[model samples]
Structures are given as C-alpha cells and as structure tokens.
Target: MDWDKLRIFHAVADAGSLTHAGESLHLSQSAVSRQIRALEESLNTTLFRRHARGLILTEQGELLFEATRTMTKRLDATAARIRDSEDEVFGELRVTTTLGFGTLWLLPRLPRLFALYPNLKIDLMLEEKLLDLPMREADVAIRMKEPSQAELIRRRLMDVRICFYANADYVARNGMPETAEALADHRLITQSPSSPQVRAGLEFSQPFVAAANHSAMTVNTYFGILQGVIHGIGIGSLPDYVTADFPDLVRVLPDVQSATIPVYLAYVEELRHSKRVCAFRDFVLEEIQSFRRRALPEAPETGHAMTP
Candidate 1:
C-alpha cells in the first residue's frame, strides 16, 4: 500500500543487508530500517529476521518482495516503452541465445550493429536454458526451435544442420570417414550426450557416439567442442553454419547431416514497438541474409523472408 516502504523493503530484501540497501537508495540505515518496520507493522507480520551477519526475508517478506519485483519490472518496462517512442535506440537490450550460436554466429556480426547504433547497449546472455520472455527474463531470444510459450512475437531466422566436423590436419592424418562404420577408426569430440541441445543435433550424433572407436570427449558447449576440433583433438559434431566462419574445419561426412533445426528469434509482445527490439530484429535478419550469401554464393539471391 505504501509505495515508498515497499520500495525500501524490496531493496533491503534484494541486498540482504540494510546498510547495503541504504547505500544503494542513498538513505541512512536507520531510515531504511524504520520503513521496513513500518511496512511489517502495517502488514501485521514479520518481514525480516535480523542477524549479526545480515537480513533474511521471512515467508511474508518473500511474498511481498515477489510482488514488488513484479511491480519493478513492469515499471521499468513502461519507462523503456516511453523511451522507445523516441528516435534513438540507446538502452540495455538483453538478448538470449544458445552458447554456440551466440559465440559463433552472433558475436562475430555484432560489430555491424554497433556501427549502426553506436549508443545501443547489448547484454548478450548465452546459455542453453530458455529464459522466460513474457516475464522479461530477456528482451529477445534466438533459439534452436520454435518457442512453445504463447503471446510471443516470434520469427524463424534460419534452419541449421548439425553435422560432423574435424580439423583439416586431423582429416589429413586419419582421412575422412566415408561411412558410419568408418567413424570407428577416429576419436570423437562433441557436445556431451547429456547436455541440453537441440533434438536434431542430439539425434544426429547418437549413431556417431556408438560408432566412434574411442569414447567421445564431451564438452557442454559447442564453442568448446569447436576448440577441441580446431586443435586436432578429434572429429566433432557442430552446426553447419560454423563452416562459413571457420574455414580450416572440414565437414567430416559431406553426405550425412542432421535434420534441419529451425532457428527462431522471439520477444515479448510488449516489446513489439520498442526501437531497440526493432533494431536488433532487423540487424539479425540482415546478417542472416549476408551469411546466406556467403554460405551459398551460387544459389539464386532470393532474399530472406519473415513469417508474420
């Protein structure tokens, strides 16, 4: 009910220390403590359990803090929307994507985006865990599959094929594996079978796992696997898009590849009008087009398409 007290309580709960929260809010510790006490009194319950070490939120405090957190995010979203109405794209845009695509595909092309919008701030969150879009976990996401979450504005960027790759020297030394049986002669470096990756990638690598004579060295991230493959550790399973950037890595079995893994770019419906989101979406689309041109120079230049 009291916005000021709620704000102070949220800060204290977030920081877990009255002194730290007071410093952040530019208020005295006594002032912050008084507000928290008043809030607890008004709510008729204990908000925090004070200890010599720090403050810990009680069950009631946790509930109130969750409410305040939601309120804070909504207010921030409103402010961002208001700022988005301006002509400048100059705020933090949190973008989430898989580790492999973020490091291999997106990071390399981000310079062009920075050149276009010099003031834009990008917070690239690279991990396999799918963040909650509508809850504002991230501003945008480039994912390996269509997002199952409703109320999201999603666009399919491209389809990636995961396949076997090896360092040129490794292939030169061991020769290429022409058949599934031939894989038995070479060591395999790939994403851990237990790691979270696209279904298509996992399915494509299963037979190779069984066929490789040596037990695979499994890295959790594609970047790690790529490094292993680059250093001549062994043949690796990786996205086909990698070859366009990594020239020294050769496709292990040209005839064999994974089923197409659809890549989708998504954001909350609330950001549909945000200039930062628009700038990022367009930048990604243009880069995907450029990547396609480089990957297939002979293919007729049918420009990239957007699905509603």
Candidate 2:
C-alpha cells in the first residue's frame, strides 16, 4: 500500500466523485482515477462500484475507509506536529466561529489580520456548529460554554451578558415589566444549560417558568431564536454585544439583571508550544482582548482580560 496513493483513494471515496476529490487534492480527474486503479490492482479487490451519478464504495472500500480515515487524521496531526518547526506562523490556519459573530465581527475584520501577518494563511470556517479541534477539523473553536475539559487549552475571553429584549413595537404593545416577577405577562423565550449557579447569580425571580413548557417555538439555533424574538414571537435573552449593536432590538428589562454566559476560546494543546500555534494564540488573544475591552459594555479593565 503506497501511502500517498492510498490517501488519494481515500479522498475520492469520501468525496464520492473523482472530480471533486481531484479538485480538493489539486490533481486532475485522470491522475486520481489512475491512482485509484493502481491502488485497487495492488490490493486485488474492487474498491468502488462505478455509477453514472458517482462512485459508491464496495464492502472492501468500506472496510478500508474505516482505517483510512483514522490514518488520515493521524497523518494530519503528525504533519502539524512536524511542521511546528516553521517559526514564522506560515501555513494554513483553520478557525471556526459562530454565525452571528462571524457575520458581524470576524469576517469583516479579517482583512486587518491578513494585512498584519502576510505570511500566515487563514481558513475561516463559519458555522453555528462547534468543531472538533484536536482532530485537525479546526485549529480553534470560539463558543459559548463553561470550559471544563482538560485536553483543550481554554481561555474565557468574555462574559457574554444576556438580557431579555423585544422589538420596540412588541414592548410598546405589551408594556414593559417593572420587575423580574412581572415578566410572565409577556412571552419569554430562552434556552437551556442555564446552571443553578447562573440562575442564582441573576436572581431570576421571574415566574415565566411557563415559557419553558409552552415556548412559542423551540429552536436549536441562536439566529433563529433571535429572529423569532425580533419578529414579535416572544422576548429573548440576547447577548449584550449583539443587542448593543442590533438596531431593531431593544432591551426591555435592563435593571432586572442578565445572565452572564462565559464565552471561551479553546484549542487542542497538541500544538501548544508550536511556534505557529503560539503566534496564532498570541495574535487572537491580543485581538480579542482589545475587542472585549473596547466593545463589551460591562468589561472591567484589569482582571477582565481572559487569563490562560
């Protein structure tokens, strides 16, 4: 089994089309097909069932895929470990962020980073889904979560203070609640993972517990929830940064208290001391610290900076 040839075949199998795999590998369709044929001939087994639409893996290919995928991941990680020698922060850096942040923040400002570090390559992945870092799916993940794991190097970048908000029309129509207890009159929209400690900290005395059971519509995504609230479906707890910037939303209960959601920037420690990784870490920390300092409404000056 030639390792490189096997790798090409693996790409073809995963992509389901030789042309797609070729595009990914920066090779042509004929070259990839020849490599696949050579690999099958050497193994003396049929790997793919050819079809007009695309290729389907045979039982042999399935068995091979299970091993190949793992090997590819290991190979990628090993390569990163080896490439750690490049002290200039050169080569591709894969990063992932949430949709709203990606749209309003990261994507717009990425050009500055590019201008600052011309040598470092960046691949910014924008999805609401959190990516696995250690597997090399993404080198970094920005998420709203309390950091608990050991394998990751977690840094609490900011406390995403969330408060209830509604459109001005909705607030005007329903009237504003004076206290947390009075919020039951308005439709309350919220999400879970609100630990007991957080609720206690917020002094959430609101009796809108019915909102938990009879939510207008249950959505798993923050963007959808925000849209629902913006359209007058209900009142939603939006991040202060988002609310502070969003023109259409208005904070209804600014005094009732808000839940502080810990935002974390996490990465696999496998490349902890690597020069490129270190360069990226330092750059991200510097950028985020500045962003949090300048942007966050309640950010403290000193201890508020996310410590390692």
TM-score of each: 0.95, 0.71
Q: What is the C-alpha lDDT of each candidate?
A: 0.88, 0.71
lDDT of 1 by residue, 1-308 (tens): 88999999999999999999999999999999899888888989998998888998888888988999989988888899999999988998999999899999999999999999999999999999999988888889999888998798888888788889998899888898898788878888778888889888888888888777776788989999999999999989899889779987888778788998888999988899899999999999888888888884653443334444
- Total backbone clashes of model 2? 0
Worst 10 residues of 1 by lDDT: 299-308
User: Compared to the true structure, candidate 2 yields what TM-score?
Assistant: 0.71
Error of 1 at 185 (Å): 0.8
Top candidate when judged by TM-score against the true structure: 1
Candidate 1, clashing residue pairs? none
Which residue ranges in model 1 land beyond 4 Å of their true spot?
Answer: 297-307
lDDT of 2 by residue, 119-144 (tens): 87877897756677766688877776
